[model samples]
Target: MEAFAVPGLPEFETGDDIATAIEAACDLRGDDVLCVASTIVSKVEGRTATLADYPAGPRAREIAARFEEQTGEERDPRFAQAVLEESTDLVMDEPFLLTETRFGHVGVNAGIDRSNTGGAELLLLPKRPSESARRIRERLSVDASVVVTDTSGRPFRHGQTGVAIGWAGMPASRDWRGETDRDGHELEVTVESVVDELAATANLVSGEGDDGTPAVVVRDWTFGDHEGSENLYRSVEGDFVRQALREWHYEQ
Candidate 1:
């Protein structure tokens, strides 16, 4: 697979479409997956809030509230967004994982950032990345996949790596249960996330380092038709309220 880093992208603004940039970077006939960082999408959508404009505490509170409203669940009331990268369980100076947001998006800074942006403009995750990807695919009129990526922290890791929080035109999870390997050994339940792998590969070129690039197109790969991230969410029956009760009762 070949990855090409797209350079010379300007500070994106609200309503600034990426159709042209994406088209120029793509090889519509060849097999390729366009991996875009959430930060650039956020910039294009103008998803920033000025910390200087509003008082820090108030701004943070408002952001937290908005996150809760968007995610339909309670989050850390004091959580603040920033720009930072993470390493992995065995490697230092490696950007292999992404952080998870309260909304279950795993990417860098929980898909938030402040660096390389306009004054006081903090970047956020795309409002609807899967939808965005679908739209881009339609615009290009090609047989390519799109992935919106972010950084995430692992279970036993001290740092973070990249992951696909949103994907279109690709299967984030491939179920290999009951299937056979080369030796006809029944694959005892192995689910692979191709989207995350694509994102990590793209990140190799579009690093947080001084590459000055935020997007990449990965060529030569076979992927499934586009689904979405909506179904990926785990169903929350009634656990949240119970957890709240546990905390409240303990306090009492």
Candidate 2:
């Protein structure tokens, strides 16, 4: 499969037609998978905000003070408040704020991005990324799949890679369980995230800085004959790492 960014896109703004802008920039085929950076998605969805919007309360001030005490770098209490407002649970409160967004995605600062924020002080993630993808998919003229992507630092990795936060018109994973390998060993638990793969491919061309290409079209990739699953995020009850983090947080 080949992926290329849609060129000549203007800096998007609130209420900009993402489907129209993409269709104007490139001719997408029905079989293609369209990957969109969450930046542009947040832009069109009007998720911009400023530090003034979130007044720092006692909890936010405490969190910021603790972070400052540990890192020796002062953090804005308003920023902490913004993170808290966007999150349903705070996974970590020291050194950095690791929190779970209301929509179930977990990330630092509840995914309230400051870089490339379309000139806003903060660019919040889409309220519901999956629904955002679905809306974009429905507006498209072709029968293409859509994946909303974000740059995410992996647990044990040094740098960040693209991860799918929202997807439409396709299952999240290609289930490989019970399938036979070359040596005839049945696959017990192998699920491939096609959306994340596509997102990474798109990011390869999308670039991190000033490329201005936030949307990419991936062509000629097929899921093949395989079972699909939509289970991606894990609940707190079953997520050992999250539980461990919580335990550590309380222990501190």
Candidate 3:
């Protein structure tokens, strides 16, 4: 499997045709998987907010005060307000707020990003990432798959890695149920998140800072037909970490 970036993309803006830009930047082939950063997708979809757009509300100020008091790290209330507005539920408030986004994604600050925006602007995750990927795939001339990716920190893990937020035209997970192992042992509960793996691999080529290459084309791999990254999400009831945290919060 080989992955390379589609370079020479100009700074994206609201209403820009991202599919056209991607096509212009790279020569796409059938069966290729395109991994695109969520920042560009948010930019094109007009999912950006400025300080002026999200003024600090009373709740924002309260949350900001609590955050600063706990972490001793000062943060802007307006930014906190923006994060709250983008989130469907707030799981934690101190250190960093772990929020469930409107799209059902649970992460820090509801995936409200401040980096890579010019100035005083915040980028939110795409309203519907799967739809965005599907649209981009339909617009491109070649038959290919698309995965919308974002940088995220994992629990009990240091540093950050790329994760698939949305995808189209390929199975997000490859279930190996009823298969055999090296010794012909029956395999169960061995589903692999191929989309996230591709996203993480593609990020190796699409650097986080100033690289200007937000999209990468991965070739030389075969994929089965599927849709979206919904299979990747764990329900709150079934998530041990979240359930434990909820119990701890209640006890506190």
Candidate 4:
């Protein structure tokens, strides 16, 4: 698959839109997948946070205090929590809280970004990436797939990598369950997260610094005309966390 890097997208104007920026960047002649950094979308839509306007230092300190108080852990968990807040989507739940973005991404943070953006404001995940993608598809007159990505901390990895929080016009996952592997044994259940893979691929070009690139286009992706970004999320019946935590607690 060929990836084209689009650099230095201008700030959005009132009437300015994602499709216009895309048209200016590349010739997306029908049937291509476009991957966008969530930061860019946030910047364009003016979704930013101002720590200076508030007592950020004191707030951070308070956060640190509250976290320690709750968990009764000595270390400052709230420092991590505050950083997480900068990147998380706050979700209200019973007893404990659950944080996840609209794209079915779950974590302590919602993928909010404080890095880059000229230090003016923190960048948030796209408001509604799938909707944004749909709009872009309609305007471009092409068979397009839109993916809005944000950097996320991995479970066992050192740093961060991009993940899909919102998508449109693309297959979110590729299932390979009940299929034969190299050993020719039937696979029980396994699904590849195509959207996350695409995000990682796009990140090769959209580096952290102001490299001037915010988007990438994949030209050789195999996609059907009617396919869109769905079928990516698994259903949750009851207290998935409780079951997992129970297993983990026993394993410990």
Best by lDDT: 2
Q: When superposed on Cα atoms, how far off is each prediction in RMSD?
A: 9.1, 1.4, 2.4, 5.7
Query: TM-score of predicted model 4?
Result: 0.72
lDDT of 2 by residue, 18-70 (tens): 99889988998899999999999999999999999999999999988988777
Flag regions of model 2 displaced more than 4 Å.
249-252
Report how far residue 172 has shifted in candidate 2, in Å: 0.2
Cα lDDT tens digits for candidate 4, 1-252? 788887557755334587778877778866777888777777766766664433446544655565556666553433334344543344322112335656556644456566766455555566677676666667775777888877777445689787777787657876666668689998775667788888888888787776767788878877433324356544344557534543442111
Which candidate model has the greater lDDT, 1 or 4?
4
- If both were scored by lDDT, which would come out higher, candidate 2 or candidate 3? 2
**Candidate topping TM-score:** 2
Report the Cα lDDT for candidate 1. 0.60
Q: After superposition, how far is residue 188 of candidate 3 from its true place, in Å?
A: 3.9
In terms of TM-score, which candidate is stronger, 1 or 4? 4
Give each model a TM-score. Answer: 0.69, 0.97, 0.93, 0.72
lDDT scores of the candidates, listed in order: 0.60, 0.91, 0.85, 0.64
Candidate 4, residue 70: the lDDT equals 60
Clashing pairs in 3: none
Task: State the lDDT of candidate 3 residue by residue for 1-252, as single tens digits.
Answer: 889999899999889988899898889998899999999999989888787888899989998888777778888898899889888777776567888887677889889888986453788899989899999999999999999999888889898888999999887888776778888998765788998899899888987899998999999887654332348878787888877766554221
